[model samples]
Target: MSASSSRPSYAAVLRLSHARRTFGAALLGRLSYGTVSLAMMLAVNRATGSYVVAGTVMALFGVMSVLLSPARAALVDRYGPRRALGPMAMSYASLLAVLAAVSWRPGAPVALVAGAAVAAGACTPPLGPTMRAVWGEVVRDKALLQRAYGLDGVAEEVLFVSGPLVVGGLLRFAPPAAGVALSAVLVASGTLAFVSSPVVRGVRPTPAVKSARRPRGGRALLQPVVVAGGVGLSLGAVDLLVVAFAEQRHHGDDVVAWVLAALSAGSALGGLLNGAFEWRTNARVRLPLLAAGLGLALAAAGLAPGLLALTVAVACAGLFVAPALTTAYLIADESAPPGFRTQAGAWVNTAVNAGGSAGAATVGLLVTHAPLGLCFALAGTVALLAAAVPAGSRMPTPTTA
Candidate 1:
């Protein structure tokens, strides 16, 4: 047996030196991402009194954030997280604060709000990528690292689900801008604690010569990126399709929420299970299989007889979501050259977001004209096609650092 006699638990992963403090602080900072989207959109809509303006501003914000992520992560790879992440977080938080102030009341200048959003988005810290890289440094054991990534994925799923609920609760007592203000504080304080951790302090910048020697091309990333993008596209279509399904069947809007909750529940469970055991096959082979399973499940969802069956099918599709993403991150990390891991992870992150955005837009158009079942099939087919990307034979074995 290659691994230790004792299987590494999630508890064991956290038990690694400095893992708890570092991971907790990183989650604290990442929570800002989950909150800021809903908060800012509400703020912009209220201040401008136009969904058009709000949507456009958010589009700019999201596009800048997603497109520039790899560039930001590359900075971290070059200068290390401590040196690179601090300034980015501070600038991002400051911009959020400015946007909050500008949006505190109705009739704020539209140009000023849009400018602030673009700047804030561009400066958004690559916290997720940075923290994943830190996990690489803190836990050298391969099995433990797998658990760490699983735990991280599950926690992130929870944060995203809860963050919007928190904002919804807050809207009862405070203005939407208050949520934005809170997001600013969260990122600022969390980043401070994160950079101060002992383990993070030890992750020094890669030497210039070593960085120069690593391959800069995208060949190693082809498999994971394509699968991740496909997964994103499929999931993105699910949200709108579910809504259309509900409305067509005379179900209320709240049904959408319940169904989506089931999906999240399935994903959380799958992530936990994915980490609990070691697999004989490495991530390269597992990646496409997980993606294909998702595609099949989603396509079957279109054939569901009623809301109950659709919910079940969607939940089944969600089972593959977290593990597929976790596996993609693993492949991205393993395939990355020395000093390039952060950028590699960021590329995968970027693909997911970009694909999701495209999927939502494309589905939005198609849902209006086509049969709901056909639209669902089209989305699932995207993932199926991506799964066909060949996993080359000469893949690296998963190894401890």
Candidate 2:
């Protein structure tokens, strides 16, 4: 095939009937995922009148989701997303609805609400990872396949950037229970449709390839996966640092909004533009450089003279965000064993979350005692450490043509 055959425009990728259908359904499935936490915390706090109780529920949810993600993805690996998505979507949504109702009732037990929240998280459909897994099947061209991964990273960032605002805004006019109910409905219906799509229905899990020559033990997560998560941890730290910076200046939420928006816009642009050009750099070399670049950017953010300068610095740093993330996905997909592709994707998700937790905890504890720059430095240092992990490890190359 000609090289041109491998590189379709974004419009072309979405224009394929199957691709179009799949994207639409996936969008709905995702609409609530990023926002659900806000919804849950609000309802729980309102019902319990205690931040401690609310926080506990949210923490448990996070823990359950991380622990269960691999198993859920493995189910998709064995049964196909078509079968796996439904039970998860329905069960998760139903559990959320029950939680919302419990929160609404004045006398509902806190433990009951917590249990439902835990179940909802454990039941999260492998929507994001599965979509990425299927793209390998849908797009035949290696170049286009790479681009698709970039696009998926950008889409996921969109959720992170917008999810809180959307959930918060809706919660303003509606009750917390209403917000959660809506979230449940959206995730359920969207995932249902996503699984029902002809294109999605046809995608099967990657079968484990066999080779006695290849060394094997317990697999999926390894050094590369840790580095992949480091990307998230670093970002999460920078995120909180930006908020602290804004608070330090007494600029409040408005400034914080500007700071995050700049980062978001830069990341979106970088992801779109990166795929347009192929790099001469090897994946091993490219991955670490991009990750370390984030550290440098975080440092720059700390050094900016003022708010305007910080915004510019953050946007510059944001430019590297998507490229680094895209590389992480490429690494995970390339590094894992065959039967473990879906499970590998789950590991990446776990790493990111685990990293975020570490970042948030470390920064939250230290930010009050140290200078904002110190916190930023800590975040930068963590990312650099993450970069080294992958640099020291071995990752097999692309198996594709």
Candidate 3:
């Protein structure tokens, strides 16, 4: 066959275009969310005169997001990306504005802040799952999708690392209100850009089959969908542990940036490698290896006696990060019913976030009572345990319904 004949057909071109648009939307959504999160932390901290209070507010935001994320995902599955993305973006912006106003007032009521946090959480755009579903539609090749995920992972790391620094600087040099206003601007700019994209504009919700009914009990938990959620939770916990370890070691301020950078860098490398491979491996092999590697790295980091050793160890831990996550993504994709693809993706994200929250809470307590090394060891052990979960169970069957 001629090279041209082997090349992606005209259909592939259209798909690529759609993928590009979806990626743009995802990037913008992440940027906006990151900015708001950073600014909110600073604003709350300044207003309450306590980091603990600020953290509580942040925790509330997480809880709200986790609780509502499934519903938002369902909305996307039911109503399509356009309908879900636009309204959620607007709501998020409005919430941020309200939060800013509340912060601007001296001694603003705690109840008011708490209420806004809940609202903000509930309004979070279902970007991760929605974008994943969009990508699935646009990218016909599995390898290409993996690359896209790697890029997405990198973008998230950049956003989180940079967002806080920007907010911190604004809070220090400009008024606290300035940071809040800047956050609002970021959200509006990013979210609006995403909603207006042609790809998003063209998306239509798939029609649900009228004969389909939800699956029953224990069988449901064993489904690939549930397993994917579990994987997400594990990943989230790893993230939280990283932060907690940094804080305990007096490296909290800069360590987050470094650790995330390392992980993103590793994931980017993995993506490139994934694209090069023409063959596939079983999750059975991939998950355990990645998890074991990560576990060892974290344990090594905990045992490190100096900053240099700690940095090296963390970077090593990051080496397996992408492969493990990609495995979870693939599992979820293969397992979900067509209409629930978006929701499945969101569930994975929610699990990760919830797991991270739990890890943070656990490490916070451990740091106070135990050695920092122990905290790191605990994270590694949990990751190792996560590796075992998939091994003991039968591989999830692909959904046909």
Candidate 4:
């Protein structure tokens, strides 16, 4: 592949035919993912009057969502997104509506609520994976693809940060169930719009095309999956650890939210800046260094003497988060067998969610028993070890399907 005469701007990525319309619709659908968890948790807690039951229900939802993701994406790989995504979005939306109705009033049956949640999770659309697949299909230039991925990553960061706030605003005049219903509308409508795009409809399934110079089999995915898991693990630990730190210092719980917001701000900035440059090294070489940088920043966050210092340290850690995840996605895209790009991306998604769940559970238990600094160190060590995982050899000739 030959380099372009000049760097491709992110605006150029959007200027591609149908890029804005397709990407906008996909983001609208993906925002449902950002909002659903908080809405469902709140609805479940209100109905059950027991935090334990709510937590258990959420755990079941999350587990099903994470475990079935690759299978859902495989459907997209096998049948093309136009055929595969519509049914998934509709089914997921219907189930969410059912969940909202069941939890609208107190004394809802626990079995019914739990069953509805599980069903909804199983049907959740593979919009994120499908969108990345679309990006790969529409954007031929590697540099422009990098910008597209970076833009996507930064927008996702903003969505997650704003999602809970959206729920909070809804609670002012409506029940949490209303938020759930709104999520259903967002996915169904957005997906309907997404599949209607001419570019999206043109993405047909293709058989795997082998390249001898590229690494074969699932082994190629090992580094990105492991490193993504490490990033997720450290991030999961950060929430609880930050709260604990705030409490220990006699600060209000609200401080935790502000600190986390700082982290997101840094991530958005990092992603934008990362996308704006052209690097001599490929993603395989850049990924491990990004992971190590995150690990070091997190480890140092533990030693901050004041809230301001801790926030700054966390923000620095945030600098690596989006770029690392973007690089992981790029690697996944490059490593995917010709027909399996959606599944390849989904595998990384699963690893991140599973690792986050494990990290939260493990750190929740350890935070009570260990020193704060030790807990932070332990969390950071997971990423450091993952960074040490050799990134494997560079592709002699990188190829995209």
Residues 1-401, candidate 4: write the lDDT tens digits.
Answer: 12221457888877777788988999889888888999999999998887899999999999999989988988888788988899999999999999999999888999999999999999989898789888877777888889988999998898888888888899999888888998999999999999999888889986655653345645458888899999999999998999999999999989999999999999999999888878789898899999999999999998999999999999999999999999999898888767788888888888888888988999999999999988888888899988887776332222222
Candidate 1 lDDT for residue 124: 91
Question: Candidate 2 — what's its lDDT?
Answer: 0.77
Q: Give all TM-scores, in the order shown.
A: 0.95, 0.91, 0.82, 0.95
Model 1 is weakest, by summed lDDT over 10 consecutive residues, at 392-401
lDDT of 3 by residue, 1-401 (tens): 01121233333332465455556657766766666777777778776677888889988887898878878887887788777767887787788788888887458777787788778888888776777676666555665565555556545656766777777777667757566667666656666776677766766776555332334211232333333333344445456556666665677566776776676566556644543444467654565666667777777787877666766777776666656665565556555565666776776677666766676666656666777777777777777766666433443322322
- What is the lDDT for 236 in model 1? 86
lDDT of 3: 0.64
lDDT per residue as tens, model 1, 1-401: 11222548898877667778888999999988889999999999999999999999999999999999988998998889889999999999999999999999999999999999999999999999889888876666788888988998999899989889988988999999999998999899889899999888988876434443434434457788888899988888889999999999999999999999988988999899998867889788888899999898889999998999999999998888899999989888877776677887888899898888989889999999999999889988998998888765223321111
Question: Regarding TM-score, does 2 or 3 come out ahead?
Answer: 2
Output the TM-score of candidate 1. Answer: 0.95
Candidate 3: RMSD to truth: 4.8
Candidate lDDT values, in order: 0.87, 0.77, 0.64, 0.87
Model 2: worst 10 consecutive residues (lDDT sum) = 212-221
